[model samples]
Target chain A: MRDILTIEAVEKKATRDGFGQGFHEVAQSNSDVVGLCADLVGSLKMQAFIKEFPERFFQVGIAEANMMGIAAGLAIGGKIPYACTFANFATGRVYDQIRQSIAYSHKNVKICASHAGVTLGEDGATHQILEDIGLMKMLPGFTVINPCDAQQTREAAIAIADHDGPCYLRFGRPGWPMFTETGSFKIGKAIQFSEGSDVSIFATGHLMWHAVEASKKLVQEGITVDLYNFHTIKPLDEEAILESIAKTGCVVTAEEHQRNGGLGDSVAQTIIRHNPVPMEYVAVNDSFGESGKPAQLLTKYGLGIDDVYAAAKRALTRK
Target chain B: MADIAELKRIASQVRRDIIRQVHAVSSGHPGGSLGCTDFMVALYFAVMNHQQSFNMDGANEDVFFLSNGHISPLWYSVLARSGYFPVKELSTFRKLDSRLQGHPATHEGLPGVRVASGSLGQGISVAIGVALSKKLKGDTQTVFVLTGDGELQEGQIWEAALYAPHNKVDNLVVTVDWNGQQIDGANDDVLSLGDLEAKWIAFGWDVMHMNGNDMEEVVNVLNEAKDKTGNGKPICILMKTEMGMGVDFMTGTHAWHGKAPNDELAEKALGQLEETLGDY
Candidate 1:
């Protein structure tokens, strides 16, 4: 396995920041691209876009449903609208608005959600939305993408602008490590960051860094493991996962979302359909997230690096 | 151009189509559809400068959205009669594999519908988006949307109501079918939407009220709405209408809000709504 632990003290930046940068850049070139933020200008990192193009940016004052409806309507007028808000409000609160107006209508709206999962620390379960993936991916034709780091998220946001359809781009609050290379994000393809043999550890969103760290620890312990970034949860890269797990004979899925309807569940379904393997999940169990620091929350909710290592070990044992 | 008499005749035919369409399916909302018949017919045939051949972008021409989409029967009838589709297709409403869904939708390539609107409180925002688009493109064309008084109870409606006028989405007109009836009894019984006109006025809108059932009054208000556009404020027409206007037994109550009439009721309703323009 490749040594991905060299950058132990790397500069940290929130994935939402990447979204802001990419959205602003995309809006500059594509005159038809517009943005609507539901009163989370600062948290969602949309100040730059709003600053650059005041005419195109809409401040929809804490009303996520209205923002979604407006985005759907904007799609009809030949404008690609990006609706930004917290994952909780973007999915759970305004789900029906997205379903009827955006998803069912097949509006060309980009639902850019920030502060997803337990990483949205100190806000408790109400703000930390662990179930947005389930809500979004279940909708027909909704392309669900959860980019791992800052560079990948920037590329993901810019990429969705070119693709035509309703999409849910989920990002987190924590200033994660910029581990992946710039412009490395692909829509439906998995990135094999490191190769191994004993087990294939698939991680997504903020969990990718932790999984990488866990792999380093496992490698020191003489356990060779394969690491794959399962960022785009829907339209999942099943071929890559099946091929990797076929070689490894076991798999461990990790995400900052819930154990039931997130990356873990997605991998399980794919593997069950194509190549059944002994799989273990390193994700938040059935309980809701609580107020704490990102690291504390990750460890408390069983999504820390230790959890990934433990889950990988369990998958290897099971196999 | 449709004369007052011709517009009234078209409305009567639309009412007939609504009844027949709902009765054929035995499912779908007919009360609201019947109530908003005149306004829809007036807007499409006379008021809005829209094309008979539907275009999704709606560039250079005015566009319409049915926010209270339970009244899909009304919109489908108006679009068909106005040449958006085959008038014969009205018979396939609510049937399996029909483009005329239970609610107005853009999917299935329904020509007239720009967005899906069965779930209430969404149409106004979409209209605001289209209006904003026109503003961005410097198109100067207007966008129109219709909502129910009951739909205003939805919180999203309040959010959109606050959004449009605040943003100066001036080239847009919203008409609330203040029929006073919802699926659950009257608006008073279901939930009192007290002082609706006052509410819109407070929300920074150009508010106007008209008797929606009166074809002449509806036509006059709609024409006035066009003149009122581009005045730096969103237009709201608080249109008062009866639940099932022309049908005797179905009127004055919310029981028939979603219920389709039986064979006898359909016959009686169709008898009252004279097919001035031949029915589908």
Candidate 2:
């Protein structure tokens, strides 16, 4: 999959747009697929789907709790309801609603969240959610997904629609380069970008683009970088993680999320269980993000391309 | 043309089952369960066109949700008497590994319950979702939900209350168990509900009122609520019930809300109500 990183992309799109297109496409094929939004029809990019399937769409006002309960109810009624809202409102605001109605009840509702993490920008700490992945992944029987780019987010949306049970699909607000191949999405399976023996790099969400950029520069410096994209956080691909770590003997995890409960912690838990490896995390260090440009937020939060490069170097030294 | 005598007999047996189940466990909410017994028994036996053999999707048939789920004893008794599960499972209320949890849940594959509800304020939203689903599929069946008057204090209840009528979710009936009592004390003492009837009317629902403890009234009002369905607006029934209705000692107070009666007290409570059906 080296060609995946080599493709110089001229097109850019937000992952939420991919979700909109993918959701609309799936709704066409399956009549059971329904859409529910909490007054974010445009922000979540669900206009086309709402226009085409007005009968299947439900506008639940700004009530996130009701939206979650309705999604669970729709699931009980045998409809695949995609309950859409900002990541903060989707997870934290209505945690009890989700815990009882959807997760504990074992309802098949897809909580499609957008504008996740520091990359949300401008809206600042209250709107930007850094702990969503941890909150959702902690719930029992929830499929947690944080796809890299637009094409992959779209593909993830379509794939999860067919995969039964409750899932949390987290995407972002800002536009990022479209690099991952379309229709190559698989749940709970990591994509190996390149094979090497120096240091293994694990990245998810918007950070994958930066990981790719940092890997190119590292390879030119004669470091063999073993890279993998972890889209699914829960039911993590431990087999792939162990295989890469065994080959490289060290690891660096990158994501536009808090270091506490996001992909970094997931990988650390896996490594501690099977093999103890020297690891470094390139993530927001136990801090709430502020209003800034997406790129500037990444730099301030220690999630830039240079951050990944520096983490990789730190892991190599420990090895 | 309903048998008021027979429904009364069933309600008595359901009340017996509720007391016995809670007494066996030494824990469970018996107050609201006792208070709402007539309404639930009337709904299951005389009101809903439900299948005794339960499925997740209650298509083409009326479905019910108990939003005030601490009263699992009441629902378990009614569901068992209605043949959703064996009547013997009434003995398993709150026991280890039993299908009957302290709160109504689908986790143990309990046939009648569609979702877990112990955390208040979510069940109304869930019922709305099912009602919307039925509307989408052109199914003519109605969705019913019961929440404690105290449960309405939850913000999510108002959120759903605002949503149902605005979206024209007409195939739904929500009945508030207006017992005026919560765990702390009277609702007035804990947190004033402040004119529930006017509140439902102000929220744009087609509101109705009934005495929940009266078996005849419960049956008639539920049938009336069913008749009101398929209109341009959703329906809400503000049901007035005593916190503890039947047993003389437990009645007129909120003290019995979550406490199970001791053996002697259980015997006294059972004496006031006849065992119209054999005990499990």
Whole-model Cα lDDT of every candidate shown, in order: 0.90, 0.92
Cα displacement (angstroms), candidate 1, residue B280, comes to 1.7
- The CAPRI category of model 1 is high
The all-Cα superposition gives candidate 2 an RMSD in Å to the true structure of 1.0
Could you tell me how far off, in angstroms, the CA of residue A255 lies in candidate 2 after the best superposition? Answer: 0.9
Those runs of model 2 whose alpha carbons end farther than 4 Å from true positions after fitting are A3-5
As a whole number from 0 to 100, the lDDT of residue B125 in candidate 1 is 88
Q: A-chain TM-score per prediction?
A: 0.97, 0.98
Listed per candidate, the RMSD to the true structure in angstroms reads 1.4, 1.0
Question: Compared with the real two-chain complex, what DockQ does model 1 have?
Answer: 0.84
Candidate 1 wrongly placed segments (more than 4 Å):
A1-9
- What are the clashing pairs of model 2? none
**Residue A2 of model 1, lDDT score:** 35
TM-score of chain A taken by itself, candidate 2:
0.98
Score every model by TM-score.
0.98, 0.99
Q: For candidate 2, write residues A149-259 as lDDT tens digits.
A: 999999998988898999999999999998887657899999988778999999999999998888888988989899999999987999999999999999999998888
